[model samples]
Target: MKILVYGAGAVGGYIGAHLIENGLDVTFLARGGHLKNIVDKGLNIVLSNQEKIVHPSYATDSLATLKNVKFDVVIVAVKAWQVRESATEILPYTSSSTLMISVQNGIDSPYELNDVFEARQIIPSVFRGICLVSEPGVVSVPSQCSWTLGEFQKNPTRAINSLLKPLIGSKLQLKVSIDEDIIKDLWKKLALIAPMSGVGALTRSVLGVCLEIKELRNMIEKAVEEIIVVAKSQNIILPDETLENSMGFYRALPYSATSSMQRDIEQKKPSELEYQTGAIVKLGKSNNVQVPVNSFIYYSLLPQELAARSDLR
Candidate 1:
């Protein structure tokens, strides 16, 4: 089966490298310096214990080169802000039979993918890991994290099975569940990340640091509560212990465990503020719920995010 991994950034590069090591036919969609680095030096994944380098079957910057080639599966591993552009680029390479997987951090991506392709053809998933692009072609994944996948609605027969069949024997941890469970999964992740992201970025602190600052920790809890209210308004109810468990995660994190969003803001790079904390504010508005803390955080970070994007341009 031919697999196309759109955007060979940290998430895509890490996943694509593993698939290549497991002997899968995978191609990466990259651009400019990243694409050149991959062609010249191949892709490298550095971990705490070991480093893996793999030259994929093909790596190119242009989608036009892939005309008439139908991919069996297309993994959309771009940032939430890049999803729309990546979807448009990968459209020509997909046929009606192609399966699409969205591995982004936000909750709105599944619906966004449905706009580009059929809902049935899209599988939504949430991933956990501390990964980043250290350089042009080198990606780092410091931790091993599992992936949770499901359709927007339950399907007796899912394309996820076929998509994951190739990596079945590998060490990839993939969990499959029904639609309701997946919705809960998304909300649960949001509950953990939205607050962590808001507090982390706003305070310019890591998880451990936030744990020490009472006010920052309180802000994190407020963000979680607001998100829970929004989730319930949408009929997605998480467990009663969700908030407490989420807080426990923050408290247990290493002193230096910084969130990706926090790191991006500190480095003045574009962050996923829109879909992470911004989503909470939007949902709260629509649900007629009050998310004062999240609103403060979102608006506070907007200027930074906008400025970073402008600078990149």
Candidate 2:
């Protein structure tokens, strides 16, 4: 199967590297210095266990080159804000049967993809890993992670299995599972990530530090509760033990663990705040649920994000 991975950042680059390493038909849609680095030195991935440099079937920045090409599986691994832009770029190359994978970390990404592609054509998945682009064409994975993917409205189990066949046995420290209810899974992940990222950025502290502080830990729990309420209002009933389980999960994480949003905020780069905590606040408001904690987090971070964008432009 021909696969196209858009945005060769940390998550996309790492997944694409493993797919190429296992001899799959993988192409990367990259641009800027990353594209140049891939063209000159190939793609380099530093795994938690080892390192690999792979040259995939193709890598390109220009859409004109791929005008006639067709991709069976298109993994949209761009950030939440870039989903619409990425879809506009890749839709021209997608046939009706093309399985569009939403690998972003937000609730609206699936709907964004559905605007251009059919909802049934979208496979919503959650990426559970800490990865980043240390440099152009270089992806650093500091821990093992997994992807929980499933059909949103269409059952593409067979196609998903076929796509996952290549990485059956590799040292990538990755796992893939099919979730029967992918939307619920997405909400569950959001419960964990939104609070963690919000509090992480707001406090400018790592996971462990956030948990160690009494007030911050309490805020984190309240944020999770708010998210659960928001999810329930949308008819997605999270588990009763979700908050506790998520707290346990975060508590077990290393002391140095910080969310990517925190890193982006610290570096003065554009962040996924709009999709992360901001989504929760919007959903809560629509549901008439008061998410004061998340609102505080969202509003507090808004100016910094706006300033970052202004500086970039």
- Pick by TM-score: which candidate is best? 2
**Runs of candidate 1 exceeding 4 Å displacement:** 157-163, 169-180, 309-313
User: What is the clash count for each candidate, in the order shown?
Assistant: 0, 0
lDDT of 1: 0.81
Tens-digit lDDT string for candidate 1 (1-313): 8999998888788778877877889999988887899999999888767787789999988777876799988889988888887788788888997878888887988888888898878878777656778888988766665566676656667555554667444333222233437767888988998898888898887788888888888888988998888999999988999889998876655677877778888999898899899998998898899999999999999988989989424
Itemize residue pairs with steric clashes in candidate 1: none
Q: RMSD of each candidate?
A: 2.7, 2.3
Scanning candidate 1 in windows of ten residues, the lowest lDDT window is 171-180
* TM-score of each model, paired residue for residue: 0.90, 0.93
lDDT of each structure?
A: 0.81, 0.86
Q: List pairs with backbone clashes in candidate 2.
A: none
Misplaced by over 4 Å in model 2 are 156-171, 311-313
